[model samples]
Target: MSDPILRLEGIHTDIAQYHILHGVDLEVPRGAVTMLLGRNGVGKTTTLRTVIGHWQARAGRILFDGAEITGAKTPDRARMGIGYVPEDMGIFSDLTVEENMTLAAATGPLDPARRDRIFEAFPPLRTFWRSPAGTLSGGQKQMLTIARAMAEERRLYLIDEPTKGLAPAIVSTMAGALRDLKRQGASILLVEQNFAVAKALGDYAAVMDDGRIVWAGEMQELATDAGLQERLMGLSMEAQ
Candidate 1:
């Protein structure tokens, strides 16, 4: 396998006197979806924030494509190819779909190509291209968030709770969109509690508990290993 596109070694994050992430270690391989699975408040979102430079890590190393990005500014990291889609979805309420996409467009000749690709992944975005962002449903908003991230050039992407509050059908649509991005070679670090969605989309899975990754392996292994699921994720057959 190739070297990881994103790697964190002993990453520790502190948010205003609160130690949220404690020596977290994980890797997002190039062109693959790496899912971070955990119950709520286990530092899953913090890890992504720290990676995107929203929350600074007081200790540890973050290397992206072999370059240390631990201290790089968020914009610098984005320019260097790391796109982040937060849980909030970051949609401008008043902005139209087309405006939102245009605002996030990467700096280069790839703008048109990116737009076309986003349209391909999200046909709904194209159909609602003239609609206000706030008028869209939860799923469409999530799609817009992802499409915005794809506007920038990136080797790795950090997405948080993308399927948080949507209908089952919309959740399936979101999953399909993620798969399309993966097919286009986007390395993704996903923070998701939706096990079914994660199982369907992830290539690798890491289970986090109390700010530390307790287990990491292939998604298939995680899917079949009921023992690990129960012990680490607190998931059971009944839950499934």
Candidate 2:
């Protein structure tokens, strides 16, 4: 990992009575995708939320680009060039696709050239420009959420399960978009269950269990070693 762009040290977070993250320590390498892998209810989503300030950490620190941001508000974090694509696909359902895209461009209207390029990648967005976001299919809604984040250039993106609950074709499309995002030199902390996507996009991999990171290393190392995979995630990537 060449100088992590984001670091979480001893991060503890709780949602009411349920303690979700129990001291997560993880690092996202600069200009690379760091895959966050774990089973259900293991705090993968919570860790990403903590970094983005959606669910504040009860203890420990979160540093983004070398500045401690544990106490920063979500809007402030967003203004500081941190983008988040939530698991639920956070987009205004009532807003038109064009309207949703326009609102997320914090620096006023989006640049025309970049917008054109985004449209090229996700052509449905262009086709449904005037349609309400609520009318989009599940895959199209996912695309809208990712496109909303890409409406402007950000230093880092915290994406949670971008390929969840989609057909194989749509999953492949999502993977390609993420690959393109990586090609553009963007740092991504991705929480993915699909091992194939994780192995394909990740440069570094971190595995979490019981709200803490149990393993951290190169994705290739984890992908190839079935024993290590079983110990950390309780299943082989080959089987999944």
The best candidate by TM-score is 2
Off by over 4 Å in 2: none
lDDT of 1 by residue, 44-128 (tens): 9999999999989999999999999999999999998899999988889799998888788757443777788788878899999
208, model 2: CA deviation in Å?
0.3
lDDT of each: 0.87, 0.92
Candidate 2 per-residue lDDT over residues 126-187, each given as its tens digit: 99999999999999999999999999998899999999889889888888888888899999
Which pairs of residues collide in candidate 2? Answer: none
Q: TM-score for candidate 2, please give it.
A: 0.97
Worst 10 residues of 1 by lDDT: 105-114
lDDT of 1 at 70: 97
TM-scores for candidates 1 onward, in order: 0.95, 0.97
